[model samples]
Every structure is written in structure tokens, then in C-alpha cells.
Target: MTRLVAVSGSLRRESANTTLLRAAIALAPSDIAVTLYEGVGDLPQFNPDIEHDAPPLVQAWRALLRDCDGIVVACPEYVHGVPGAFKNALDWVVGSTELAGKRVALINASGRAVHCHAALVEIITTMGWIVVDQASPVIPVAGKNYTQADMIGNPALAQPLLAALHAMAGVPAMAD
Candidate 1:
């Protein structure tokens, strides 16, 4: 099975980004097992000294990132940039080999989040992640425009995004 980790950058209970992630999960093919990392808000700031022992929460996130076949990040822009909480969680993995050269997809749910998504892409690329070009299909206003449960029901955006994800998984994995 292709183990995919879907990380929702928003901590809000009713956040658009989180809803977008849920919709993605709902749309995923059954053979691909999806796990959602839902605790970014609890991760402490990254510090090398503290990392020597690695807090339990940080370790858990590191393990998840390490073992996943691929990753999907649904992030919402805050003040025209990536949210601090999500960035902090990502910062903890910088020094580890866990996520180096991993496949990642970035989904920007709202039109206002383009800059933030760009910034996040830059950061993730620098971290040695191979981001799929077709993954960002412009899912403008996932929550405000559509109900949280039906975010991925939009055929226009969902078709391309799902195709991108499956394409990233490729044929051999599917044929098996």
C-alpha cells in the first residue's frame, strides 16, 4: 500500500485548509492508505539542543514523515505567509534525513494563499523534497465557497488534483 501523510497546517477546528485535507482524504483511492497529522499546534519550536533528546511529539512527527511514501500539505496563508505553527513543525525535521528527498504536494485552498503557498514551496524544495508541478490546481476558497465536507466534490479542481496525486504514485504501484 502507498502510505500517504496528509498534513493540515491549520489548527482551527473549522479551518478551510483542514477541510481541504479531509476532502483530499475522502477522494483518495482505496488502495492508498492515508494518515492525517493533526497536531502541528502542539509541536515545540525547533532547537538543536532539545533535539538531541527529541521530545515525544517531535519524534512522532519525524517518524511519520520518515515512513510515508508521499506527503500532501494543505496550508492556509496567515498575514501573507505560512503559519508559524506549521513552519515550526517543519523546522524540526530540517537536520534529519527523514524527509530528505521525499515526494510532497502542496495544496493552496484559497486564492489569497498563493503567496503563502509559494513561500512554502520554496521552503519545502530547499529541504530536498520533490514537489509535483501538477499538484497545485488552484482550489480557491475551499471552506468559504464550499462546505467543508464537500470541498473536493468540485470536479474541476478535484479531477486535476487527484490525477496529480495518482500520477505521483505512478503505474507500477498501481499495477501491483
Candidate 2:
């Protein structure tokens, strides 16, 4: 099975990014398992002093990334940059070898979040991750109170997400 971890950069309870990921989970094929990583909000701030001896949460985060075949990130832009909490989560793994050569698919829930998306691409690329262009799509779900079912039901949102999952799985997208 091609396992992919989906992460939402927003920590908000009603985050559209998180909802988009949930839709991805629902739309993923059986062969491609999409697991949502919910520990970003719980992760402690990054500190270089404790790099070698990281806390349990950081360790667990690394382990998950190490085990997964790829990662799907949906992030929101804050003041035209990546969110602090999400950036902190990425910082914790910057020194580790877990993300080297890993495939990452960036899902943009808002079309206006270009800045954060670009920043994320730079950050992940610097960490040795291979960003899959086909998998990275701007779905534009911002400001809309979209439920998981709403996203899953709409082909406009679902088709691209399904294609993204297939791209991450290194497989050709099947005809619907």
C-alpha cells in the first residue's frame, strides 16, 4: 500500500484545510491510504539545543514521516506567509534524514495563498523532499464552509484530489 500522511497547517477547529484533507481521505483509493497527521498543534516549539535528544512528540512525528511513502500538506497563509505552528513543525524535522527524497503533495485550499505555498515548496525542497507537481493543486476552498461530504460530492473538488492521490501513489489516474 502507498501510505501518505496528510497535514493541515491550520490549527483552527473549523479549518477548510483540514476539511480538504478529510475529503482527500474519503476520495483516496483503497490501495492508497491517506492518514491525517493531527499532532502539528500539539508539537512543541523547535529548539536546536535539543535536536539530538528530541521530545517524544517530535520523535513520534519523525517516525510517522519516516514510515510514510509520501506526504500531503494543505496549509493556510498568515499575513502572506506560512503559519508559525506549521513552520515550527517543519523546523523540528529539518535536521533529520526522515524527509530525504520523500514525495510531498501540496494542496492549496485557497487560491490566494500563493505565498505560503511557495514558501512551503522552498522549505520542503531544502529538506530534500521531491514535490510532485501533478499532486500539488489549488483547490480553492477558502471562506466557504465546506463539509467533508460537500467536497467529496463535488466532482470539481473530488476529481483533482483523486488525481493528486494517484500521482502520489505513482500510478496513472483511473477513469471515473
Candidate 3:
């Protein structure tokens, strides 16, 4: 099975980006298992002084990234850029080797995310990770509050989602 760990950029209890990751997990193919990782919000702010002996949470976070086959990020734009909390989470791994050569897919669950996505792509690429281009979509699901069951019931949600998964898996895109 292809094990994927998904991260949502929002810290809100009712974040659409979190819902979108759940939906993606539900819509994935049988061979792929997507697990949503909620540690981004729980991570301590990056501290370069303590890089060698990192905090327990940072250690756990890196361990998770190392164990996963791929990573998927569902994010919302904050003032035309990535959220500071999410950015901090990324910073925690800036010097780690966990993400090197791993496959990653970006899902922008906001209407205006061009700049944010571009910046993210650059960051992920700089980490030596391969960003699955076709799977990266600015889906604009900010306020939709969709759940797994809702996506399973709606082809509009399921199809493109499956397509994104397929892209990440290096398979041809699925039809809607």
C-alpha cells in the first residue's frame, strides 16, 4: 500500500482545508492509504539553537515524514502567502533529510492561492522533494465544510480528487 501523510495548514477546528484532506483520504484508491497529520499546529516554533537535539514533537514529526511514502498538503492562503504556523512547521524540517526525494502533492483550498502555491512549490523543490505537478490543484474549498461521506457521494468532489491521487501515484488521471 502507498502510505500518504496529509497536512492541513489551518489550525481552526472548522477549517475547510482539514475537511478537504479527509475527503481526499476517502476518495483515494484502495491501494493508497492517506492519514491526516495534525501535528503542524502542535509543533513548537523553529529554533535553530536547538537543532541538534530537537524537541520530542519535532522528532515525532520527522519520524512520521520518514515513514510515509508521500506527503500531501492541503492549505489555505493567508494574505497571499502560506500561513505562518504552517511555514514554521516546514522550518522545523528545513535541515532534516526526511523529505529528500519524497513525492509531494499540494492542494490549495482557497480561491486566491497562486502566489502561495508558487512559493510552496519552490520550497518543496528546494527540499529535494518531487512535487507532483498534476496533483497540485487550487480547489477553493475554504468555506465548504465538506466531509469524507459528502465527497464519496459527490462525483464533482470524488473524481478530481481521485485524479489528484492518480497523479501522485504516477497513474493516468481518472475521469469525472
Candidate 4:
């Protein structure tokens, strides 16, 4: 099974970002195993001064990313850009070698409004990670204008996201 480390950018108890992560978890193929690293909000501010020996939490986060086959990020928009907390989390990943050449997929749960996808793509690419082009899942809120209540049950939204996950996991070949 492919081991995937998925992280949500939001730390709110009822955040749409967290809800979107849950949706991704449900979309995972049975063959791919997903392990979520919660409490992104609890991580300390990234400091270049303390780069040699990382804090326990930072170390733990890095370890997971390094070990996993791929990384999935679900994020919300802030001030027409990436969330500060989300940016900070990415900062902690700078010194780690795990991110180099890793496969990454991004999902923005912002409904209707055009997201910061372009900006985020630039940032992820600059980090030396391979962002899957065809697998982009930018869910601009469909018809109902989207709300927490509208997210959970819609198979239409879920199916495409599932396809993205399957692509990230890389489809297995048929046996001879």
C-alpha cells in the first residue's frame, strides 16, 4: 500500500479546510493508506536559528513527510492568498530533505471564488517538489454557493477528488 501523509491547513474545530481533508480521506482508494498529521496549529513558528536540531513536533512532521510516498495538502484562502498558518507550516519543511522530488497535490476548498492556486503552484514548484499537473483539484463551489452543509454528501464533488487521489497513488498495472 502507498503511504500518504495528508495535512489540513486549518486548525479550526469546524473549519472548512478540515472538512475538505475529511472528504479527501473518504476519497482514498482502498489500496492507498492515508495517515493524517493533526494539530498543524500547534507547531511552533519556523526559526532558521534552530535549524540544526528541530523541535520534537517539527521533527515528527518532517519524519512523516520523508517516509510517506506522497503529500496532500488541503487549504483555505486568506487575504486573497495562502493562509499565514499554512505558510508557516511550509516554512518548517524548508530544512528537511523529504520534500525534494516528492509528489504533491493541492486542493483548495474555496467555493465559487477563484483560489490562490496559481500562487501556490509557483511556491510548491520552487520548493523542488513535483506538483502533478493533471491531478489539480480546484473545487470552486458548485451551484449552491457552497457551505459546510453542502460539502459532505455530494458525490459529484467527491468523485473528481477521488480520481486525483488515485492518480497521486499511481494506478497499479494489471497482472499477466
Clashing pairs in 4: 111-141, 112-141
Give the poorly placed runs of model 2, Cα more than 4 Å off.
none
**What TM-score, computed on C-alpha atoms, does each candidate reach?**
0.89, 0.98, 0.92, 0.85
On a 0 to 100 scale, what is the lDDT of residue 91 in model 3? 89
Ranking by lDDT: 2, 3, 1, 4
Worst 10 residues of 2 by lDDT: 93-102
Candidate 3 has a TM-score of 0.92
Q: Please give the range of 10 consecutive residues that has the lowest summed lDDT in model 4.
A: 140-149
Better of 2 and 4 by lDDT: 2
Q: What lDDT does candidate 3 reach at residue 120?
A: 90
Question: Candidate 3, residues 1-176: lDDT per residue as tens digits?
Answer: 88899999889998888888888887788988898999888888899999879999999998899999888998777888889999998888888875689889898776577888888998889988888888877676677777667756877666777788887777797554
TM-score of candidate 1 relative to the true fold: 0.89
Deviating ranges (above 4 Å) for candidate 4: 111-115, 141-152, 172-176
**Model 1 lDDT per residue over 112-147, tens place:** 777888898899999888887666556776557566
- For model 2, residues 1-176, the per-residue Cα lDDT tens digits are 99999999999999999999999998887899999999999999999999889999999999999999999999999999999999999999998885699999999999998899999999999999999999999998888999999999999999999999999998989897
TM-score of 2: 0.98
Q: What is the C-alpha lDDT of each candidate?
A: 0.79, 0.94, 0.83, 0.73
Best by TM-score: 2
Task: Give the higher-TM-score candidate: 2 or 4.
Answer: 2
lDDT of 4 by residue, 27-137 (tens): 576787777779588889888988777789888888888999988877776676877877888888866765799888787666543456667788788888788754567
RMSD of each: 3.0, 0.7, 1.6, 3.7
1 against 2, candidate with superior lDDT: 2
Ranking by TM-score: 2, 3, 1, 4
lDDT of 4: 0.73
